[model samples]
Target: MALTPLSWCVGAALALVCGSSWPKMHSALAPENEVPLRPTTWLPEGKITSVTLPKGKTRRLYFTLKKASAMSVTISPCDLPIEWSLAARTLKDKPLKSLHWTTKKSMPEVWWRGPGTEEKIHSFTGDAVNTFSGPSHPRTSIYILRLRSKQQSTRATVYLHEGPGPSGTFPLLPADSNVHTLGVGMTSVTLSWAPSPSTTSLHNAENSYNYCVLVNSLQNYPSLCAAKVSMRKEKDQKQDKKERRVTVWPILKEWWWQQWDTYPEDQSPSASLEDEYDDLQCVCDGTDSVCTVSELLPDTQYYFDVFVIDRLNGTNAAYKGTFARTHEEARPAITSLREGELRWVTFGDLRSNSEQFFSFRPRGWQQSGLLTLQSCGGGDKVKVTVSSKGQVLTSQGVGGDLVHIWLQGSPSYLIHLEREGSTTGQISSVKDQALPGALMASVKMQISSAYHRRGVPSLPSTLQIKSFNRLRGCSSVTLAWMGTEERSLYCVYRRKLEKLEAEGVSTLTAPCLGPESRSDTERVLCKYFQELNPRRAVTTAVIGGLEPGRAYVFDVYLMRRWGIPIKYASKMVKTRKEC
Candidate 1:
């Protein structure tokens, strides 16, 4: 949902910004056959909160509301010989009934769908097919599909847009777009805007940028994401008029992770951009899985964007960043694990190709089937596993943009994909390797990638649960463990084992450790993990006061599901007093 092609400014500089509350701004104003724009419901005056993706195709366009009423979106593609598709669903997973497409693209052939609504789409290029097949369309953009609560947690909606390749922060953007003052050191600011969940391959887009900010409270930031803007201009700040626009083509490194202590006499695109552009996408190239957050600076208000870099004609987006004096660290550091890593998600072999149907016949070859890694943020990457069962494809890591992952895929007989995400995570256009002609499948591929963390974190691993003991009257307990000793950060969890009643989940949200450790120095090391040896120094916990002879049980947990789940149920154990 990039800004609609509509230009609000009559004279560019005279643009009038318009956006407010949802029910009021995007409610339906246009009637069914209205050919012209309505004052209240036109796209320029409406709000689009979600986008959906059915299996087999990347998301290209989505529905928007002129005033909370359903409105059809029309795309022109603007001189580019690009092909696109559409996916839609209710935020609650309900299949949207009635709606169809017909095109006139002539050359590449056309395909379209819509079972309920038989409106014949007028097209000149390809054949049309019905897309709304059945129920359970693998929930691509789950956020916009689900009901959201302001306090519980933010949900996310995902989209896969067409791209020139890796286009992140917009090219030719005004230099001051990201300039901000905050005015006050530590005040909360609310940003309302929209982004295009384009399915275009990150490798094809030449310019792009997305806004990302760490939000506090599962309630305040309940949308799972805020906005994806190229520049980070603080509401309205004043600076020398000369600094308003700067040619950023030369200094692209500013988009990645780094310090901007030295303002370039002129901005030079960071070489790192070119070094990693070809290898970026929300997921590992040639695979359905996506790349997660790779690096993040602690305690910095990073004005961030995801951009695809462009070159002699390939796609690309540049990573962008900005620092603010006072804003809480909004997201789990690139080093910290959010919530899903320890959870479970699966990836299956791509089953649908664009060519099968007549409505939207996607080229099975040009658009290789994809396996998606659930997003960390609607369009952010997540931790994914892509092992060839018997083959060794090392983790290559994400390039400059936050979406891409570098890996090797070739030959035959050895291909798989898996991912984990929910409304709390992100997902976007994930790239899969082009299917190789059986002859060149495997050849000592150096591809390497695993769960992409936003910052430096101890890799997730399996753990062995040891014995547990009771200590004080305060729901006291002790446990032993050993794993991820080399991790730069870690978190611990404790829960009563009784809740594991067969096929069940636990209502747990308790911390076992303080904020992540900043350094692995000797003093910090000794304070965290000590060698108790045979004694098995128990990691103890004492919540409020408990009855002396009460029975209690505890289970030690980690943010990772690397090993068999460990538990110590209170109902299964007795609470000891001064034992």
Candidate 2:
């Protein structure tokens, strides 16, 4: 049974009062108790150590205090989201109750359960969560730290210092007041606030408080602001201010795998915000009362929280917050790129309908080129689609602000760049697609014919569309294709003939197919087929939920396991009229 907060506190207090020696415990419950132990290591004092936590596995770390002193344990900054607990065992304390004592080389280790003798100091779980203060014993004892990764394998850094940390109460003062913006720009916001009077005494540079500026695009500011800030006071050293770059291939592979079928509507607004903004929360230090928050989205409101933190303990002394919308951005003129030339393109000003299109022609027959798109960081907001002759070669969202696409000889390839819009409930005053937030990035788009020398990857020879049902139901159609390759990936795209004509989209130039469009006539159905049976030479698929009495064009693209769509076949079909 899990203990309530009150019960847990009461149990811990009783454990401290009835401190019993481990050796005095029942023989069966002694240190030489159970079988095999999990991975264990000793945590060194006064140095930083990096450790890896296997997925869903628990690792033990032991640290011995030489004397009775206050020890400070700091879990350094990391991206892995994990759960960790700190416990201390003294010579006079008995083995924690209900905890399995597994021995390794005759030494006992605790596993999970504990409602008795062991004093549990603290526990934390979440992404980028760090600890700065540890349990303190009046006398020397062994501190055992256990780390468990939630679902994925990740690395963690730990700093163990044997001494007293900074002296002060957590959140030393009340919440800050008069938190307001000083100025707002298309991509930045300047904020100013009054410092708590209690913090004025520590104005000296040596003992100054560091203000942690927490910014996020979501409205869940309270919990975000309440998160611990890990700031270590390290000696001055050269800092690498370079931003991290995201590669495009992994994202492209993911897009190809998902087949670009679902849209933002398939997910809840809050859940969408959580996933997209997981890395969007940025923390910076404002040593003074004023700070400037940059790299914000144009015409979007962002929540800001400033916490007065002590440098020593990394504790939030006080906090203040406000929300402000960025200024409207002017649409930038598109500059055409010549072959082998790199050009910077600005994306994300919705007032001017910031979707920009560019076309590229391969230099040789069936030639190939490497198309690279790069951003400062958080490039997932910029969506890219490369198409030739109305068939989408590839479409995917860029992660880490970087992506690469290999273009095979399409006489000319059309590239579309646009800001992915905010979801419903993001901004109540604006429509769902009206406000595009936080994607104001000057992404670099470049196309080079270097792949021509590398040789274009060959298309599958046996893949071809065999036939389709001429008579179709009001909402469905059947298509059959022949391919000997059992491991290839396939996607079926459907576009309305009437809408294609109205938009002036010819059978030869339609790349705009995907769920991104608002109208069914313009939307591309992202139907996927994978893991074809090797025994069967023919594969069949039924396209459903289509409009009746509508003439539609369907395209089948054959892709390799590596996510490159090499061979494709297109056909036009008309759905039967509604009865």
Candidate 3:
């Protein structure tokens, strides 16, 4: 069922009049003179009491009813009742955006589904509106809204009727002088009248108020209007001053834009920017200050000067600056095989003369230096070295200080480098894929000694082990060997692999090397080993608890002797748990 828009059909059918006869449900709800409606309802089950519809920026309805909440009845397009349809035709007004009829039952999902959710037309079945529930209170509807001020007209009409509905028509608002303060405490004020005398968005109404105080005191007349307007004009003048003055950014030499700002007021203007930064770039874009140099490659150094003309001052202001070259010349980072196949890489090293520019030989210490890729991915083991080999193109001369990195043929690995480095320009990295060159992989004699000289002993000296078994496993049958682990305080650990589980070492003895002992020492060692095998290696040394009847796992190792490898027994065994 649909209700009609608020209005009466002049020459339409008699039954078409709002609240005319309850003979049948109306398709629409138009304004009714008076009609009987049911009482004791949250919505206007009966005719709604006359409501005053305010106008202007704010428009709303106010009905004097004994209900805690309200349901905004509406005349939807479809299913308009006979009377509703007639009233709708008679009334001409703004088109509707959305309208919904609701009942209390649908309150919970109201905020979610919104106003027009119900399907069946009108008759106020308490459809969706009944469902619209809020904090036991409904937000007052505000319409005729002004976006900027959010102001609405205060004039709208309301229909009053007897419930089970109303009997006759009546204006809800009584004539009263409504005075709202405008620009309180200010000399000048703006006032507006709501429910504009002329209705609609295009028609604006002028509602004026006379200030009693200003009228009584003629002395302050200038302060209230005309003079105040003059003051406002002056205020605007001050604001425009900012637009008149233009500040110039300092010029820098080098190609990149300098990463900096003008010096603080206290800092000397002529103070040295010598090493502050070398990053700056500028585009003169063909103006009077049009760049003397037009075309340039990316990340290149540049210095420029422009004679800025001051239209107001009629003078030339010189803007000069310098900046360094951007990173146009990039060498693949230093990352390569730590072992396996060798992939050669170079950074800041010797280059053939043809590819040289302001070349300077790298220092002696730099010969063995490693360059950080800043970010490297996969197994990209890299080494830095100078090659006098003939791999230079005649035109591209390499400089002594420049390290021209050539991906020697296609290697087996495709390395991806992540973004790496410090905020302050550190080093650069590259993503590369290449095949292995004739310079096959080999264990460098120098590197072997280098590792040893660094106090790193051979792997054969200590049998601490890469792992007892799989780095991630919990089976108890496993055994660990020890290399030179005689003095090593050995312990065993167990935990559910993959799943989070507690790991510890404990003690329980069964068989040694499979029911037989290699020596008296083996027996004692094995016995003690069982005693402390499952102790909480990190927290305690109870040489603690172990499942008495199950064979517990153990790992053997010597502490601080990591660089050395110690010999090991095949597999020290423990018997089933006795418990």
- Which candidate ranks first by TM-score, i.e. highest? 2
In model 2, what is the error at residue 12, expressed in angstroms? 47
Write the number of the candidate with greater lDDT, choosing between 1 and 2: 2
- Native-referenced Cα lDDT, model 2: 0.55
lDDT of each: 0.27, 0.55, 0.24
TM-score of each predicted structure versus truth: 0.18, 0.32, 0.17
Q: Superposing all C-alpha atoms, what RMSD in Å does each candidate have to the true structure?
A: 35.6, 28.3, 33.0
Q: Lowest lDDT 10-mer window, candidate 1?
A: 353-362
lDDT of 3: 0.24
| Candidate 3 Cα misplacement greater than 4 A, ranges | 1-302, 305-455, 460-480, 484-545, 561-579
lDDT of 1 at 226: 27
lDDT of 2 at 566: 33
lDDT of 2 by residue, 1-579 (tens): 887999999999888667654334443342443454444567867554667778898877887777735777655324457788888765554455454333332233442222234678888887543555644676434678888887777666666777676334333444545567888899988878776554665545334444556665543222221222111111122135332121110011222112112224455322322232234334333336777877666998777766554433323432445779898888554445568666555654557656788877767665777777754323226678888888999998753323768777667788888767543343222122222233444456667665324533333445445445564688988877765434555566666677656354444222211122235554344434433454454667788888887877676665433322333445677778864
Model 1 gets an lDDT of 0.27
Question: Model 2 off-target regions past 4 Å?
Answer: 1-38, 91-117, 128-135, 138-141, 165-180, 185-188, 193-287, 293-297, 301-323, 329-579
The better-scoring model by TM-score among 2 and 3 is 2
